[model samples]
Target: MTRAMGRLLDDAAEGGRITPDEALLLYTDAPLHALGQAADVVRRRRYPDNIATYIIDRNINYTNVCVTACKFCAFYRAPGHKEGWTHSDEEILRRCGEAVELGATQIMLQGGHSPELGIEWYERIFAAIKASYPQLTLHSLGASEVVHIGRTSNLDHATVIARLHAAGLDSFAGAGAEILVERPRTAIAPLKEKGEVWLDVMATAHGLGVESTATFMMGTGETNAERIEHLRMIRDVQDRTGGFRSFIPWTYQPENNHLKGRTQATSLEYLRMVAVARLFFDNVNHLQGSWLTTGKDIGQLTLHYGADDLGSVMLEENVVSSAGARHRSNRTELIELIRGAGRIPAQRDTLYRHLAVHRDPAEDPVDDRVHSHVSSTALNLVPVAAAG
Candidate 1:
């Protein structure tokens, strides 16, 4: 690394923010460990507690029937594909019961952009879940889905979000934001909404007092400049409204996907993204490492590379898992992963409040039943009859 670059990272580590150009340079020119060290230093300064956190949550993919056929995704089936199925209310409630039984504090309903499933469909499902599990956080939906709902229901983005919020939508999950830059976004998810639309929807939601995280899907043949551009887009929006709770960067799962695994982000690339995102997103609070996609070792390594959160135990993750994410962990293993990274493990809620800190390994909770991808009917793709 050049002395200038070293000084730049030093400034960032010492709490000085860097511009987008400087971040891109640091992300490109800096050595892996150099960036990791500087990023970890910044992380340590912010989180002096030396605690790396993980959440015990479930991603309940409400449906897999989508219209926008993003080439990189293997999970979405067309509107009327026989394999496409929507879970019945009883089935969804049963999964919620399982998540609660296994101690999941957050439940994310990751549905598809089915034209049939409009605003009323979402409201009914969310209301039913909230009615049954008022204590569980309804951290479901994303900006792209919000846009789809508005189009389907002929309502504005704000109206769609407000109604969903009233129906027990706790927070927006930053899904479907593969690469916010137009070039990569268009190349990868052409049918989805544009990057500006995603940003505007999130900004609107923030105005309405709803917050969300920002996720960037990496390794879809995007150039380094485009990657930095993606972060810049998010950071600009975040500066206006501090609605994004965290920034998560995960690699695309290439297997069983339409993109054909022709382009993939290596583990080193993923780590660089984690470090760069932490340094760049000074306004954002948390940075999450994608354990489910990059595997447990890289996930653990990310704790030292500027990631304060190891993402969720992911009691069930169908969308990514179907594409190639195979990593699974229960509460016990997740705590171990955090502790292995030389930090105390804390089970956090959706808002990132510490629910339980496993300071003592001897006292760690043992719950093996909370396996990820555990028995979701969609997990095996043997779709049940679609919900009416």
Candidate 2:
């Protein structure tokens, strides 16, 4: 490391925060390896233990029909279109049952912004899920959904959050926050809520004692300054509300999407953003790496770059898969990757509670059922043709 870079790291480690200018230099000027090293130092200071964590959860996308025609989204189908569909309550509950059977402690109930589903629709569904599986945490929705609910129900953001909380909405998955910059946000997700509106909804939820995490989508043609600006926005909000539990950054997958693979972020850029996120978001407590988007190798490399969480061994994922991300890994594979990175792996619940720690790698549970399945099987499935 250069003398200036060493000084910056020393100051960051000694209780001093890096300025936005320094962060810009790190993002644009610093070498990739040096950035990773600095971020690793920050990670050690925050979490000294050698153990990294993973969550056991499933993403249950309720519907793909949406009114908002976000350019970057490959998951949503236009409302009333032939491809549009919503899961029945029974089907949703059955999936929840499967997740619980697979030892999942959390269900991320996410979907598109359907105009037909009103606030009452969410209340009833959430209530039914809670009634049946009271132990399962409903870590679902994002600010965009909340904003839609508020508009649909003719209530304020706080009212929507409170009602959802009453209906067993435990937390948010921090979806819909692609870039948090107005230009790129408008460019990609024009019909969705604005960047500040998303933050406002989160702030309102925090005020009502409903803590949630924040997310950023990198490689959407956003500049490095804009990425740091995104973190600064979240950090400023965390400074006041302190409701953000973690900050997760993932790369944008652009396949089978409306953008038509216009631009995609590289693996190195993804790691740089992750490292910069840890260095910049000093107030945030946790940093999660997205293996689903970045793949296993980059995922392991992230552990040394300020990431303490390996995201989730997703029992199922639809959003990214719909967007052409096919990377998949089972529980044993994830554990091995973490171990290879020289960190102990622990399974965690939705609330970050350690359920079980795998100290002996030899004893890791083996499972080989990890693969991407179509989001809509009934409509999209094709029967195999037997050849004579």
Candidate 3:
């Protein structure tokens, strides 16, 4: 490791946070292998041989009719458009039932910003879900949704988060945070909430005793400085509230989106960010590798770079599918991947509770008949039965 890289790891080990300049050095100057080594050291220090964790969850996009018109999102259709859709509560519950049957303990309730659905709409839906499947954890929405509800209802951020929490909204998914820099955020999602407002809402949520994860959308033509700036912003809030549980940074999927194929960040850049985030965000507890966007090999590689969590099996997804991300893996395949990376595989709940840990690498399942299917959305692909 370089002198600066060694110092950076030592700072994190000594409970001293690295400066933004140090973060930039790690992002730009540190050798890839050295960076991964430092990050793995940090991970081992935090979670020793505990196996990279994954959650079994389903992303239930309740609707796709959005008014925000984010330039990079292809999932939303304009209000009143014939193709726009909103799932009935029954349809949503059925999907939840499917997830529950599949041993999913978490449900991600997310969708576009529909003016028709107010705070009361969410309250009713959450109440219904909780009343029916009281065991399922609802890890839904994000700072942007909080901002939207507050603005739409003319209530403060605290009121919106408080009311939602009371209605059984468990935690924020840290979505809607494309890049926290004002320029890139405005360029991609101009009509949505401001960068500061996103953080403000999260802080409010944290203060209300509602913990959440913080996220950044990488590879959006942002400077390395801006990327570090995003981490700095989250770290500042974490210093105050101590409510962020994890930080996840994923590359932007460029295909079939409005931005029309802007330069995407390479795997090297993504891994560097992963390592830098681990080195910089000393307070945040977990770092997740987004295999869904980066593919399985890169996902396995990320375990060495301070990512102790592999995100989720997804069960179902639509947002990235709309943008042309096609990576898919089953539970057995995921376990093998983790084992192949020389780590044990553990199934975790939304709150990082270990439900089951597979220790014997020999127990990995082999399913040779598995085949990938192309879903209607770019991110929703699944398997189809063979023709008789």
* Top candidate (TM-score): 1
Off by over 4 Å in 3: 1-6, 9-15, 362-388
Of 1 and 2, the candidate ahead on TM-score is 1
For candidate 1, give the lDDT.
Answer: 0.88
State the C-alpha lDDT per candidate.
0.88, 0.83, 0.83
The TM-scores, one per candidate, come to 0.97, 0.94, 0.93
By TM-score rank, best first, the candidates go 1, 2, 3
- Report model 3's TM-score to 2 decimal places: 0.93
Off by over 4 Å in 1: 377-388
What would the per-residue lDDT of candidate 1 be over residues 237-308, giving only the tens digit for each residue?
Answer: 999999999999999987666677899999998999899888988999999998889999999999999999
User: What is candidate 2's lDDT per residue for 157-234, written digit by digit as tens?
Assistant: 988999999999999878988888899899988888989999999999999988898998888788888888898888
| Positional deviation of residue 164's Cα in model 3 after best superposition, in angstroms | 1.0
Candidate 3, 1-388: lDDT as tens digits: 6675677766664557789988887789888887778778888888876588888788899988788888777688778877778999998898788778777799889998888888999998999999989989999999988887877788888999999999999999899988988998888888988889899989988988899999988887788899999999999999999999999999888765677667688999999999889888889999999888899999988998889988887877887767778788777877877888888899899889889898976765454322122122433334221111
